[model samples]
Each structure stands twice: as structure tokens, then as C-alpha cells.
Target chain A: MTRMFYSLLLLSSLALAEPGTVIRKTDLRDKPFLDAAVVGNVSSNTQVDIQSRKGAWMQVKLPSGQAGWIKLLNVRTSSGTTSSSTALANVIKTGSSGKTVTTGVKGLSAEEIQNARPNLAEVAKMSSYAANSADAQKTAQANQLIAVQVPAFANSTPTTAPGSNIYQERRR
Target chain B: MKKQFLLPFALAAAITASLSAPAHALDLGKLLSGDTLSKGLSVLSNAGEALNTSVKGLTPEQEEALGHNVMANLLGAAPLMNDAKVQRYVNQVGLWVAMQSEQPNLNWRFGVIDTPNINSFAAAGGYILITRGLWDRIRSEAELAAILGHEITHVTQKHHVKALISSKSQQAGSDLISIVADYNSSKSGAKAGEKGGKALSEIFVRGLDKNDEYVADVNGMVLAARAGYNPYALVSVLQLLGSVNASDSTVALLFSTHPSPQERLDNIDQVVGEKLEGYADATENTKRFNQVKR
Candidate 1:
């Protein structure tokens, strides 16, 4: 009776991670960029807690209480609980045989897509509703979207490593 | 690259195959004539038709025709959400990006399918659709642009048409299927029509070539940047997708049909690499996005 059990640890654990472990030798960088100086390195299967994500980078805290970024592909998350139980948890089944069946869940399930019959009228409508280039250009101008020149990945900014996997996929 | 033999090679094969028909014998009802006329003719005819479908080049006009049927089937699967405001907003964003694509002159239209799943489709002839679920997850106009840019890349690259034509499983006659009347008259053609429908469905279920997908990701980033959006916004959307577990029904089809989100993110990092830090303050257009979304 002298001590009370508080669920603070459990709450905090759930808040910090999906309980991830590194799958390869990974550098912990000061920032998400690969060119950022490596503050430390963690070996394969090293346990770490995932904190946040940016593009391919994940901000993670290591077992040693040090935190930095890791490539998202380098770590695997341990499953805690199944998020949804039903075949499609969010789907709203309006009717089985109805042509226009939609539930609150919103979109078609994979099964429905596989079984769908062609609707020519709808297809025609989709075709007729197209936006011309002038309309598109005006919309962009309204949104203040100024086109920028972006190089193809082959001609991308030079990377720190010459033969990195990042640039290899283009040729692959 | 797919092993797309030249038309002359296919024609040669077809001619050679037709010539090899059992021309040596003719029998009258002792079972020789029955096999020679009926089954033999059917096999040769099926082979010729199959070869025709295989080698036929889909011109830009024919590509649009193929997309029409595919779009019909997609609409049957999931109808567009019935909100004109949302639809127009999405179309505005989509059209802006489409103008920057390879097929900028092709009529471009975008729609939001009323499903709560993470999915998008690019029909040939410049039609793109995204599920409301994925739409809801987008936090900024730039993120929305990023998503549209990826889907639009599929159109610009002609990924769907190439996949549709090169698909060995679907009979080539399906490419010409315009009206139900095309499927109604002949028995063999009817069977081929059914196969064609199933093929369209299967194409949606599986996906385009893996390399095509990778290319879309790379090209999509470039297109987004060109449209005056933060190219990295796609990564934000990808991160959100990656955070969701595969068991979640929201991503059920997406995970099954796509390369894992992690690989896509990694590829993005590779393509953009160290260039990300410089665009950290790129325009996100949060106010406009919030106003148009929902």
C-alpha cells in the first residue's frame, strides 16, 4: 500500500514509438539530409525509439538516450495492436446488389473494383469535363504558382558519394 | 524494357503459324473433316487475333479510346464524390499540374472518388482520380499538388497505355471494345470481351510495371517542383502513409498494389538527396489548401 502503480510509463512508451529496431548499419545525422555530419553510428538490429518523420528520414532516440535522424527504410517497426478488425473497418456497406452502393467509409474496396461493371455514361461525363490548357494556366497564375526548372534525377545536384543508391535507381 | 517484337516479326510469326495448319489431309465425316474445319480454323483464328492484339500499336487516339473503357470500369467501381466544389477545387489543382506534363495539350480532368482509402489512378488521355481518404490526409496545397503530380506523371509517361497494351493476359480485342454491341454478336468475341473486362479489373488490382512506378516517383517530384510546389511535399504525404501499419484497411489495396512506402521514400531521398535542405521554406499554401479541402 506504500506505493501506487501509475500508467505513466505505458502511456509514454506508446507516445514515443511503434517500437522500432534498426535493420542495417545506420548513421545518426544531425539533420535529415544525408550530407549532414554523422554524429554517431548504430549497428544492425540496434533498438531505437522512433519520434517523427520527414520524407525518408526518421528522427529517432537510441537506447543510449541520444537522438538523431535515420533513413526510414533502415528501421522496422514492431507491431503493437491491429488498428482495425473488420475486412475494411471504415467502410459503410449500403447494399449488396445496388449499382450505386456507398457507405460512410467512402471509396470502393478492392473486391468492388475487381467486380465493377463498365459505366459508359459516367465515362463520357469524365471525358467531357476536361479543363483546357488556358484554364489550367489561369488557375496556376491565380495560385501564384511560378514554374521552376527542376533537373532530372540524372542531372541532379552532385551528391557526397559518387556511387550512392539514391542516384542508382534512375539507371535501374 | 518489354520484349516488344516488331510488327513485321509478329506478322511473320502469324503467317508461319497459319501456313502450318494441317494442310496435308481432307476427310469426309470419318472425324478427319470435323477436326480440320472447326477446331483447326478456330485455333488459327484465335492465334491470328491474339497476335493482332499483341502487335497493334495504340496511337494517341486509340490510347484515348482504351482509357474511355478503363474509366468506365473505374467509375463503376467507385463513383466520383458528388460535391461540385470539391471536384472543381481538385480539378483546378490538377489542371495546373497537367499543363506542365508531357501531354499538356491533351484534355486533363481530375476527380475525387468518394472512398476513404489511400489510392489514386491515372487513366490514359489525361484523367486522374484520387480517393477522398488520401485527399483528407493532405495538409497543404503543395502536398495536394505533389499527389496530383505523381498521378499525372503516370499519364505523361503513358504508363497505363503501355501496361494495357503489353498486358499478355488481356486479349487485344479489349482495346477496341467501345460499345456493349461489340461483345454481343459473336460467341468467341463475347468470351474475349469478358476476358477483356476481367483484364481491366486485374490491371487495377495489380499495377503498372515496377520500373514505371519508380519513374513516376522521380518524374513526379520534378513536375511538382516545376508547378511551383515544394517537391518534398510528396515525402510528407509518403511519411504519413508509411506511419500507418499495413494491417490498417485504409492502406490494404495500396500496400498490396504498390512497392512499400519505405522504398518509395528512400528513392525520393536518393533523387533529391542533399538538395532538400535548400527548399525547406518552399511555399506550402496552407491557407488555400485548407479552404479548398473538404
Candidate 2:
């Protein structure tokens, strides 16, 4: 059954049909650039099967089997999902000490985080990355980035009730 | 504390004595009848007020500690990118943007995590990390500054603190408030503290509320502009993300955790549309960015 499934997966990848919907009205061109002859216009919400990508354009085939490229940003993948949720379990491997140890994946899965012990060593390591206010100020001056106060917010009236510890400079 | 309430009541009694003495005699008699119940209720109300004050979000110190733990968990997933220059560059750019925020003195540290996933994180305190993949994709410092600006807003606004309480709304009550209140002293928590700690780490997995994300987007632009970087860099990056194939594995993690790039682009555009003088004159610094990135 596993062999059958692997073959089916390979077959599916060979004959792909990843449908996506257009996000906005953009030109469907013979080539990826705007200079190419406009084959047609793929209006917003129009569906197209994504084939491949050029620099910034997605090559898609129309339902009528005519293939062309569309601006990559114009479409949303129909079946594509962002599932970085904690589904993968903790990985266990044998260490040099000849004992098994549990380590997490490259990007933590949620379960691994829930079960993993607190890493104080890692916490201290990140702290070494700290840049103090003075050092930060130097970076600004070097870049010629002057601090300009944008008076969009009401400085006098804070958004939240100012706690005793909150440093509020009331120019009022 | 009782004396404070007595002063107000004494003044009120003095004022009412002149006009409503006869009327007050009847009211006073009624009050005396249930004086015990009223006094108990007043004490309870004051206790409620005290609890409300205590539940107010973390002090900067507590927030700082929370950010460290959260950042540690994130680093556990992806270690810090081993380039000191790159890390230093992120800190300088991020700190410049943060200095203009409300919490200027926050221990703002920026890191580039060594991961292929294209995602940036903002914790409760001023800890932020942009993955190496996202760093490589950005073409200019202004764009990077804009991204940091958005994440910094999350910190300044205490979105992570609020998110911890919110995600546990089902079992909310005093226990929820206790998690926020006791978050300051890491050792002060019971099982509630344990739950809150778990939730804080889970922030990397569970993104903030959509409204909070939008608020960060708009305000981040403002901060980025104030720091003298082109504010529209955020929008341009949003457009770039929108252009990337949604099914692409590099961006799949980002795609799940944030509002659709199209939605964020439209929402943030509304914020950028609000005219502020000289924002157009903001710097993009494409050349310096390319050099630093290299």
C-alpha cells in the first residue's frame, strides 16, 4: 500500500494541477514581462492552474489549455495552505554520550515547544545580541537617520491609562 | 485608605445637609437599616478595583523577562544566524526604529534566526527576530526597517501580553488576570503561571489577533517614517510577498501566521494613505542596504 501511495504521489507531481485565483486584474502575457504581447486579461477572481515561475511572474495555464504567464502576486493558491502548526513530534537521536536525546525541528513545532524544557542557556545567548541605546544612536547618526517626531498620536493623552512605571513625557 | 473615602462623603454630607436634611433623614434611616450589607459591598467593590489595578499589564521588567523566554523558545527552533555583522545590522536598524516608539528604553535586541522559513517575530518585550530567508529576500534597508517597525509596534503596544490572556479566554477569570499580574515575578506563579509560560512560548506558533496585527502595520509605518526610512517600504514588501507563489514552501509558514499579504497590503495602504508632511521625502537607502546585506 505504501509503494502504491508513493507511485501515486510521484504521478500527481508529474501531472500537476495547482489551481489559484487571481487577486487583481493583470495582463496574461505570452512571456513573463509587461512588454510581451497580451494574450488575454485575467480579471480579479479568475482561476488559473499555476505551472512554474519566472523572476516575479507565475506561468499558468488557462482552462482552455493555452499556457501563459501572469504576475505572481495576482493569484492566491486554491489548495495551498500555511500549516506551520505543531504537528511534527519531537525528534530523538543518539548523542555522542551514546544516549538518546530529544531535539526539536529547525522551526519549532507547537508540541515540541509545549513539551520541551526551558532553555536558559539559549535565553542568555540571545541576550548577547543586545544593542544598547547609545550604540543604536550611533547607528542612526552614521546612516544620517535623524529622529523626527511624527505627531500623529496624541502625546499628552496616552492610548492606555499610564501606569506608574510608564515613562510619559507630557509636552502639554 | 478609609480616610480617603470619608473625606468625599463628609463633603457630600455637608452639601446635602442644607437642602435635603428632611429627605436625607428618611434616606439615612434606610441606609442604617442595611448599613452592614452596604459596607460589605463597598469593601468588595474596593477589592475589585484593587484586582483591576493588579491585573494591569506587566511592568517593563516583567515584560523584558517574558520576551527573553519567548525569544529563547524561538531560538531553540532556529539558532541565531551565525553572522555577527548581519545580527549587528539588524539591531542597529531595529533599534533606530524602536527609539522613536513609546518605550524607547526597552532592551531592544534584534536577531536573524537561521531558518529557511520566511517569517519575522515580535515578542511581548522588545525582542524581535527576522528569519534569514526573509532577510535575503528584502532588497533594501528601508524595507527591513519597515518590517522591524511593524514588529516593534507589537512590543510597544503589549500585544503579546494581551494575546496570552485572550487565547485562554475559555478558562478566563481571576486566574487569567493572575497570570498577567504575577508575570513580573517569575517565581510567583502556580499552575496558572505554568500555563501562561506555555502560552507565551506558543506565541511563535499562534500569531496575534488580526486587529493587533493591523494596528501594528499602521503604527509601524509611522515609526519607520519617524526614524527617517521610507514608510512605504512596508507596502512594497507586502507587494513582493503577494507576488511570491502562495504554495512556495519558503513562505508557507508566513502565509499561515499573518493575514493574507493582499489583505495586509490593502489595510496598511489605508494607513499609509493618511498624509503626513515630508513622508514622501523619507529615505529608502537601497545602496547602503545592499552593501550591509552582502
Candidate 3:
């Protein structure tokens, strides 16, 4: 089963989907090393836009706009997510109108991107990205990671003494 | 036979000598009655009175002189008034009470004696001495007036003369009154015996008998009431004295000389009986005194 999974993962990487591949692991380390800082994690079968590739790593953009390099063999592509080529075409067509296009292939188009600002409205729209898109998954995963890592009350432990100097005087 | 005649003659001459001097050297204890003692006391009362009446007695100048001397001795004994206000307050109260007293004609000097003992005393002259400790404990001007009245009554009633007569008899039996007057009448002899006379005077002040004490208390209440003081001032002063323990020297002296506070208080109740209706309430005095700082 492991051999089959590895073969399928390699095949998906070579025949990258429109955005390249799907996330192969339910979680990924946020840092480069096995011991690197876990800034966030990803879920398996979650599709993300593969913006660029290096020797053994692919830099993918989650719908939440967080981009990081994951092992090439750890993700496969979905056909619908805009590939770098399509993103480049969209930008050039808009730029040909003598209007400013969005900066990168992986970045959003100027008009659509303006509407798809990464805030509450953009994130709530199901049509903005896949229903269970990698970006959404990563956002959810980041939240979960944060929930486990830091307590909501961590900041609530009184940063200032109750009643200020008056409390201190009473204490004395 | 001649030696026998000489012995009889010598014995007869000795008997004659004894008989000749017999009346002059009689024991005062044997000669004076308690009535005579009371009379002699009235005489001493007269001495204090003579300050007003007779020229031979203490003159205003002499009373002032005595007061100055007493005040000097007092200042030496206990320098008073760390606060000018307390001194002024005492003087004010004392002057007011003196105005109401029988001795209003004479200038009464008031003072605070710096002592921890709760004590107050008035001398034969119009010198009133109050101790700070007593002031600290008293609750009202009426109470202070009562204490002063009790002491002043001792002066006004001639308790000292009775005290002196008793003292003289106790010391010299019959010789005291007879020899003392002759000694006082002669300038040279009295001046010669003035040292001894002063010692007896000290005794008179200190050695008051129980009767003198009772008479003083009885008269003190009348005087205090006459002066518009609440009769209860006597009772309240006694109550304050009673609360202090016996080990307190001032309280002991006060209790020793004055009538038992409980009895005096009761006596006041009986004497002032129906008249209690008219006395002014000292509540204002009490309230003013309540926070008086020691």
C-alpha cells in the first residue's frame, strides 16, 4: 500500500494539475526541517495552487494567502485551480489594456483580486475558492494549531494590576 | 539627825518647785476636749478668715505674699503648663469658680501640678493645685469644680486649725497651744522657734483627722451647689476616683481623707433630694470636657 501511494504521489507530481497537486499529508511542518518551527500544517487531499517548484520542493499558495514550500512528493494537483500559466495569461491580457495587472501568476487578477480581499467577506464566499480548498484547510488548520498552541486567556492574565496605583496602595 | 533634816528639807523644796510649775507644763491631750479642739479649729478657721476680718491675721498683701510663696514652691515642685492653652483653660475655669465662691473677694491662684498621680488640693491660702493626671481623667467642669470645692471647703471651714490643734496635742500633749501662742506672740522667740513652728505647720497640712475630713466634704457640697455647680459633680468626681485602683497614691490620699465616694454620693442624693429639680445640667460642660486634650 505504501509503494502504491508513493507511486501515485510521484505520478501526480509529474503530471501536475492546473495548480499542480493535492496535499498528501493531513499536516505539514511550517518550517523546512523535521525539527523546524511548525508555523502551520496542511490536510491530506486538500488542493492548493502550486506557484513555483525547486529541486525537491513546490511552493504552494493556500486560499488563505499563506505560501510555503512543501515536499513535491507530499502533494498532487487539482485541475480547476488556476495554474501559473493561466494566471500569467490573465495578468497579460489585463496588462495589454494599459491597465495595471496583478504582480505574479500566483497572485490574484487586479479586478477579481480586489473583490477577493483576504478578509471576512472574501473567506466566507464558497465560490472564491474550492469548498474544501487547501487555503481554507490551511486557515482552519492554522486556527486549530493556534487553539492548541496558545490559550485564549493567555493575554487576559491582568497585564495591569487591578485598580492601578490605588490597588497597590491598598495592598501596602 | 542633821542629815535626816537636810533630806526632808531638800524633798520639801523639790515638791514646792514641782507644785509651782505644775499649771504651766500640763499635758495638752489632758487639757483639751474634742470640743476645744473643734474650737481651736474654728480659731484656725478664723486665721483664714482673719485674712478678711482682723488686721492681725493674714492681710491682702500677706495673702498675696503667701500665694506668691506657695506658687513659687509649686513651680519648684512641679513646673506646669507645657501648653499655654491648658494653663489658660485651668486659670479660666478656676477664676470662674472663684468668682462664685465665698472667697471671691480674695484673688484665687490656680495651677496645674505636673504629676502622673490623679490629685488636686487647695491650701489654706487661695492656692488651688490640680494635677495633670486628674485633669486627664475628669469628664466635666462640674466634676473639677466638685473636687476644688471639697479642697476649698477645707480652707474655708478652718479644718486646718482643728488639724493644727490636734497635731499640736499629738506632738506636745498640753504644751503645744500654750507655748506656741507665746512663742508666736514674741518676735524674737518666734523667730528663734520659727524653724520648729514651720515643721508643725507642715504637720497640720498633712495630718488631718477623720472628722475634719467629714466636715470638709459636708461643707464642700454646699459650697459647690452655691457656686452653681451640679451636685452630681461631687458624685462624678468620686466615681472617677473610685474607678482608679488603690495602688494609685493620689487616689489613696483622696480616698483616705475624703468621705468614701459612695457614701458622699449618697449623702448628696439625700441632701439635694427635692432640690435636685433646679440644678443646671452639666451636659454642656461634659461635652466640652469630653475631648479636652491631655
Candidate 4:
């Protein structure tokens, strides 16, 4: 019964489809793998509804109602709506008022940084919360986080190619 | 030839003396007198040469001190959030991610400032702070690790320190002298603190080079992956940020300081490609994160 409830919960979460746009030309695959059968071809700037994510792929429904998996990075999710609309969407989607609760509270602005005065006391307070290396290791162990040996990428400047697979050469 | 060389030195000395100790300002005439001028020029020339060499790098101790000063100034802008639990949680996550960095032994400290600004800061040494606004937006421990990993790369790469050095080199003599003067005077009064704060603020407001930010993005993913967290957590966070309206005041400073979210995502895609796909199933720790986040 509990498993059924959890499955229902998962379904409810996936029901909230997010809007996204494919930023490049890519193949929509029947399965979430590089060698998977291609179901369709999505061109740059095609709008779609993102259904779910699996590893480096996202399951999305194209405007023509075709559902398939695309490379996650190829699509840009749309959350660029105006604040009021976002707040309204959050209310309907999350069943809560959202960030509007803190609406009137002032946030840090560029001008505040410009005329800031040093607050040494707060800095001192921040120090008291510092975590040591052993403690950090303990936290990692408790969470079953094993350290891995991923290598550094070759340092390069940003280039204009969006779909270029230049990183393949640097992979060990 | 000698006078021509000495003239700029005399002006620098006059300016330095006036700025560092306004009460005992040295006149250009006094600086130009034969014995005094020769001795002062020799000292100033030696100092300028030292500054030139030192501009290439700072000692770890020097970097820590500068970071401390910058952190204090940042606190002045927005004091830390008062919740000890949240502060402690952030530190644990941050230190764990930072341990995967090259400089694992550095004294790492992390905090969440009280402001609602959607941004994070990385000072020279190992100081990292995320604003409450950004903090509230984070969904899981993996996401927090990814963000902290990004800031940690900034420190490990010495992006801010290099920026400071390059900016100092641009001003060469006078600014270097003033900084030394400021350090010496910092021992006695708040005046030096005020001056340092202003200088640090200008850098923070202007933000780092776009290329440096891009480098941090890619390296941050590597760091998170090394720490056994899903590298895609950062992509999710960026997607969330991209969804926010650009004109929102909460993200005003962040948007100005960073490339637009779409641009950053595009750059990450171009750079990282499929290298991190293997680690996508690493720990997300959503349950513990949700429990502690409240």
C-alpha cells in the first residue's frame, strides 16, 4: 500500500510538465542512449514540453504530440515568464503561495555592495561554523559518497559551436 | 636623463606621502631636493620593481588575508543568516565538495548571508557565501554541492586573486603603494578598512571575466562529480535560474554579474559535452536535504 502511494506521488510530480525549447538540432531517440533508435529530428528553436529527465537525456513531447528523448543540454527550459505570472504558476502548481510570501522584503542590490561597510563581527561569526576536513569526510561517508577520479578538462576559451563534440578528444 | 627618471618618482612620492599620511604631506620641492630626491627615488624604484614581480602571484597567507578582508566587506553588505543549523549544514556540504578540489587543506568556511539576492560569492582564500535567496531555491544536497563546487573552482583557480593582481598592475606604482600603506594603517584604525572595502566592492560589482566564469562552470561539474554527486545538479540549478524572469530584482546583481542563464547553459553544453554522463546517477540525497533545508 505504501509502495502504491509512493508510485502515485511520483506520477503526480511527473504530471507537472515544464515548457522548454530545443536550442540546437538533435535527434529525438526512442530510448535514452546514444545508440538508441531515432524517433524524430528536432531542429533548433523548436518548443516542447519536458516530461522527465533520465541521466543526460530528457523525455520531451514535441509540439506535434510526439514524445521522445533528447539530449538534456539541447533544450532550454522556459521559466522566463514575468514574476507575477511565475508566482501565479507556482501557486497553482505547488499548491502554495510561493516566493510571494517574502515579496516586500528587500534583497541585496548592487548599490548596497557599492557603499558597504565591513562587518567584522559577522565575519567572525561565520568562522565559528567552519567544518574541518575530517568532519567533511565523515559527512561524505555517512551519505555513501565515494570519491572518484574524474580528470580536469583541457582549459579552453568558450567557442561558438553548440553541437560540436570537441570534448571527445580530451576524454581519457 | 637622471632628472627625467626622478621626476615621476618625486610625483609618486608626493602623492603616496600625501595619501598615506595626509598630516605629514611631502611637497614635490622637498621630494626633488638632491639627497632626499636620490634616496627616495632609489627606494621607490626598488618598491616598484618588487610590486611588478609580486603582481604575478600572492603567497597563500597573503591570499587568505585579502580574502578575509573581502569577506568582511561582503558581510557589511549583507550579514549572515542567523540560523545556526542552516549555516552548519551549508559548511558541511561546502567543505565536502571543496575537499575534492586541489587545495583541500585550506581552511574552508561557508555561510549563507541573510539577503534575498540570488547569488554566491567566492573570496580569494576558501571563503564562500550563498545568499538566502539562492539558498531557498536549492532543492537537494547535490544541488548545493554543485553550487559550492562552482564557487570552490573560483578559489582553486585563483580567479579573483588574479583579477586583483591584474587590476593592481594596471595602476602599478601609486595603487601598490596605497595598498601597502592601507595594510600598515589597517593595524591602527578603521580608515584602512573603509578604503579596502571600497576597492573590493568595485571588483565584486564589476564581476569576473566571462571566460573565467565559463571555466568555473565546467570545473565545478568535475568537482561535484569527484565528490560523488551528480554533475547534472548544476544544470538543473541553471535551468531553474533560466526560468526566472531576467528583470526580477532578486536576481538583478546575479544577472548583471553572470552571463545569461541560456548563454551559460549553451556554453556548458559546448564545453562539457558528454564527459560527465556517467556520473548522472550519483547521490542526490533529497530526503536529508529537504529535512535539513527547513
Ranking of candidates on TM-score, top first: 4, 1, 2, 3
Candidate 2 clashes between residue pairs 3 or more apart in a chain or in different chains: A23-A74, A86-A110
| Candidate no. 3 TM-score | 0.44
TM-score of each: 0.67, 0.60, 0.44, 0.77
Summing lDDT over every window of 10 consecutive residues in candidate 2 chain A, give the lowest-scoring window: A86-95
Candidate 2 stretches greater than 4 Å from native:
A1-108, A153-172, B1-57, B167-196, B274-277, B286-288
Clashes of each: 5, 2, 10, 1
Off-target runs (Cα >4 Å) in candidate 3 are A1-172, B1-75, B167-169, B172-212, B226-228, B280-294
Say which candidate scores most in TM-score: 4
Q: TM-score of B chain for each model?
A: 0.73, 0.72, 0.64, 0.77
Candidate 4, which segments miss by more than 4 Å at Cα?
Answer: A1-15, A35-38, A82-103, A156-172, B1-56, B165-177, B181-190
Q: State the number of backbone clashes in model 3.
A: 10
Q: After the best TM-score superposition of candidate 3, give how far the Cα of residue B81 lies from its true spot, in angstroms.
A: 4.0
Write candidate 3's Cα lDDT for B92-121 as tens digits: 455544544556545555666444445665
Better candidate number, 1 or 4, judged by lDDT: 4
State each model's CA lDDT, in order.
0.61, 0.60, 0.43, 0.71
Candidate 1, residue B127: the lDDT equals 75
- Candidate ranking (lDDT, best to worst): 4, 1, 2, 3
Candidate 4 per-residue lDDT, tens place, B131-241, comes to: 877877777788899899989988887767444433222332344456556554444224544555456556677776666677788888999999998888888788878
